[model samples]
Target: SPRFIALCPTTLSSSSSSGAVDEEEQRLRSDLRERFLRTLLLMTDKQVEFNMHEKVRVRARFGASDIDVLNFQVSGLETPLGVQKEALLRCQDVISCSFEL
Candidate 1:
């Protein structure tokens, strides 16, 4: 196995130590979270397609997601055997999900 070695400094120096950095970080996090929540709200009752690892894919009607975003509650989940009335899908199992904007 070949390993690459760093030839330069790997860290950058920062001088700003005020609370401004914390405030800005919080603001950005809040804004991003708000956008994500709005997207979830809009996706409710709409069809969504999920792509999982190992080339597995599924389609379901969006219902809701947990606060931690660890799981999603969906309805009419299509499986290989049949459609499930309702199901909870682990977020970690999903590689990506998509819906019409």
Candidate 2:
């Protein structure tokens, strides 16, 4: 993952002394990534509200996200103008998103 690589540049380089520490860090990062992916999977097809930049908020049915989690695909996206049948939201514009159980 590009984000992972950017966050942990040391993982890409060779370091013998901290190899054990690197392995542990990699394991923890893997677990976190797995959990995040599972959460996204659970959010699929659910009604979600996305809070975006400039105090913009919209609701939609969650579809899927790109592999890098840089964008979200949604259906029935409600906006100020009208409801969009389908839309893709940039993750950078979104501050947070939520859905009820």
Give lDDT per model, in order: 0.82, 0.93
**Candidate 2, residue 88: lDDT:** 97
Off by over 4 Å in 2: 1-4
> Number of the top candidate by lDDT?
2
- List, in order, the clash count of every candidate structure: 0, 0
The residue-by-residue lDDT of candidate 1 on 51-92, one tens digit each, is 998898999999999877899999999987899999999999
Against the hidden true structure, what lDDT does model 2 obtain? Answer: 0.93
Instruction: State which candidate has the highest TM-score.
Output: 2
Worst 10 residues of 1 by lDDT: 1-10
TM-score between model 2 and native: 0.89
lDDT of 2 by residue, 27-57 (tens): 9989998999999999999999999999999
Query: How many clashing pairs does model 2 include?
Result: 0
Query: In candidate 1, which residue ranges exceed 4 Å CA deviation?
Result: 1-16
